[model samples]
Target: MKKLTSWALIRQNLSRKPVRTGILAVIVFLFSFTLYCGTVIGQGLSQGTRTTAERLGADALFVPYGYDAKVQSSLLRGEPSSFYMDRRFSEEVRQEKGVEKVTAQLFIATLKASCCTLPVQLIGIDPETDFVVRPWMASAIDRPMRDDEVVVGSKIVGQVGDTLTLFGKELTIAARLEPTGMGFDTSVFLEIDRARRLLLASELGPRLNLPAGLDRNAFVSSTLIKAAPATDIKELVNRISQKYAAAYNLDFVVVAGMITDMAAKLSFFSRCIHVFSGVLWVLGALVMALVFSALIRERKKEFAVLRIIGASRSALGRIVMREALLVSLSGAFAGVAAAMLVTTLFNAYIGAVLDAPSLEPGPLYRLAAAAGALLLGLMTGPLACLPAMRKLGRIDAYIIMREEL
Candidate 1:
């Protein structure tokens, strides 16, 4: 007969009690699955919030009065909307103290655009004055966008060189930007001059009911402001409110303030997930301990026979620990694999359910999280079996056999 090595003995032990081994493995699986999912979601929310702050690239946004929420929805949720205000307000903001730069964007919504099944947002920006979108666009396009060309967000349906039709005019796709996990992902960007021309020529222009003959250069949806270094943003906001609040009917969306609020909410939600995962881990460990203790009693006679056949106390203890290690490793690998698959497949659904911008974590982050979960999973088996190992070490072959008789 082949030699019954330690590993072979472990395999025999596990195979003999397949149902019991399966139960122990399942407990560890549940713990690892919850931990991995929680870690991914927490990391995603934090990354998304950081990316949003960077992408905003403005100290404050100025939009038509009572449209602050609409602007927020469009920016954060990829919702399409159209609105306009006098572009003169943007020029005036540029002259304010503490204002380093001001760039205007025109918002237009296209209904059933050729590029998408649903409406899409069209943003017109001036490359010369734009600080927000242009910096991000550099990664996608090497040169400035022409009046008839457009750069699209990652989530937009078409590829570079594809043509998109909007409001009866055709535009070429100059480039496609990387995903930022923000509303811009579904938007089309073009020169402000072209956007102004499209709006003027389209039927939507008359619907605005502007104050008699507002020139194309006079239309703007919003203005993004960059403050001078070390400038007090609050004071700048107060000054703008006092100067243009009444005259231009302007509302402010402080980029920093929005990010701060989002971070706080994300932090709270992350904490809840962690706390719940911790509880599940503790419960899993306790249940494993109980099942292992019971397993020790049932295997007493079998272990006594091994001791009688010349197996030392230390050898018996090793057998139990090796079994535990094998089972734990098997379950841990399965759990982590399942978690990663589910998260990747339903990532968009998760973001919608959480009602927040969420970026998938990078590969390094994912690898680290998997390592942590596997470590915990590996520890669970060893820790739960420590007491059982101690009990097996003190077993008396003669007494155990007599009792069995």
Candidate 2:
């Protein structure tokens, strides 16, 4: 008789219990899939919150009070809108005790600005006195932005020097900003004067609700502010309210507040998801332990025969370990495949539900995450067999064989 090789014996053992092994593998697959998804979601939450805060770059924002909802919507959706405020109040806002710098912007809605022919939000910033918009483009844009020139968002499907036509005015795409995971990714930034020229030249002027003979330079949509050092932002808000009383309707969007809200809400939601995954993991481990224990009991007669053939106690344990390892490894790979597919297919929808502006982590980060998850899954199998291993030394194979006889 040919001596059975270790691999052959292990293969035969697994074939004999196909049903049990498959069930165990399926459980691992489900547990691993849920855990991996939770990890990716958490990564997205962190990335979205940080990107939003850094992109806004304003300590505080002041917009038309009654139209606060509209302002927020425009910023979030990157849709063009028309609203006007007295540009003169900018000085008053800057002169406030806790205010450091103040700048105002004009937001114009355009048709056919987006590559897909959707409306695009065009933001105009004063190059001479601007701090917010220009700084974001510092790394990408080297020179002054000329008339008929624009800086496109990272999401815009074009490169530097690409020409895009908006409202019949040709715009040279001078620079492109990195993704902010928000409306900024979809907006076009250009010189304030150039924006004013385009608005005044366009046929949509009358429909934009501009005052008769309005001075473009004298109107602004909202004021962006940077508060002074050690200033209590809440107090600064109060001052802006009192000082600009009746002159402007004020709706303040503090950067700190926005970040706090985003972080808090997402953190809470992620925790709940993780807890759900955790429960599944524990339940899977429990089922795995029970299954392995029963497997050892049912195979007692087989173990006794192997012992009679001179197979040691340690050899039997090794066989059981191999079965568990094979089940775990197969399930882990399957789970990872499922998770990758789910994240890729429904990430956009998931991002929306989680209020994560974007779920685009860099390629390197994604690769590392996948590798880590695979390694973690590999370890779970050995861990699941610990309870069964403890009973291996005391399992009396000979006594069980005699009772069966």
Candidate 3:
């Protein structure tokens, strides 16, 4: 009987002011939408960062002695830098016990001849053996680089077949690879031989003067190694560093450290996003609390009448809370649905705009958002009723009747 009475009372309150109820519903919908959109965006950014990291498959990276800072700057912030290492070190590293595969790359910092506005990171790799990063890249573009051909990053404005003049020589763009949201997206990749020729053509080329007939391809900027599963990756890195230090008489920096550092930076950004989302959620709760509190105050007399008719204070409080919970849950649900729909519709466009991988919100994210909303609603319900409940407690049946007279 109490349950039925509560339901009837709820229906009566809702019907009494249909216009006000409709307005409150709209407010709830808007609040929910804000919460849902913030959560989806935060989840998308976190996923995108992790995906980029996973795609870069190198267990450890080997670079020149002092170029560690340069390498990290390039990877994280798209800064232009160069490094150099002897090709002999590549061969020796491959001969190590736990080394599975070793690949060397030459990176050149050069300006485009046609449009020399910004610097470009030109990468030179042996097409035959370079399979670690974006293994499917070769197949995706079909034709491989020849003597004077190059593959451009997806963000490269030039199209396939267009001639891009670097260091005064023109090279054809054979293909374009997908964007990785890293410095690579702004880079151009070509055969080691071609890149060497372009580097030597510059005025600063004399600084790196080579032997009269030495093969330019015999030297590289860095080597990337994939160690055996049984091998400790860090141990392998330390061993390789020592070996390269003794053999080449040059500094050897680990690329894996740079990757780990990048991961840490990404994690920091994720936390910042989480905090911002949390703040927005709190603001939404506060708004709901104010709206509910005002509604309760206006319904004081109605609550008093219920109290007069043998309704327990606990029962009146439950009804008030039930109304708040219903409104909050409905709003939250509507907001989340709208956010998902918006995310789905614009995900591709957002990925392109950000020049990062597409954002993917997993199942865990949805479950957490739902749970958070429920807890928030429950907490806000009681707080919103405090003032009205106090007023109801003080009202006597005779006093209310006298006021009514």
User: Evaluated with lDDT, which candidate comes out highest?
Assistant: 1
lDDT string, candidate 1, 107-215, tens digits: 8888879999979999999888999999999988989888789999888999799999988889999999988877898899999989888877878766756644456
Q: For each candidate, give its TM-score against the true structure.
A: 0.91, 0.86, 0.65
Every candidate's CA RMSD: 2.5, 3.2, 7.3
Runs off by more than 4 Å, candidate 3:
1-49, 112-117, 207-218, 246-272, 298-405
Worst 10 residues of 2 by lDDT: 206-215
The number of residue pairs in model 3 that clash at the backbone is: 3
Query: In terms of TM-score, how similar is model 3 to the real structure?
Result: 0.65
| Full-model lDDT for every candidate | 0.85, 0.76, 0.66
Can you give the lDDT of residue 363 in candidate 2?
65
| Cα-lDDT of candidate 3 | 0.66
Best by TM-score: 1
Cα-lDDT of candidate 2? 0.76
lDDT by residue (tens digit), candidate 3, 335-379: 566766877687545544544444547668866775664455344
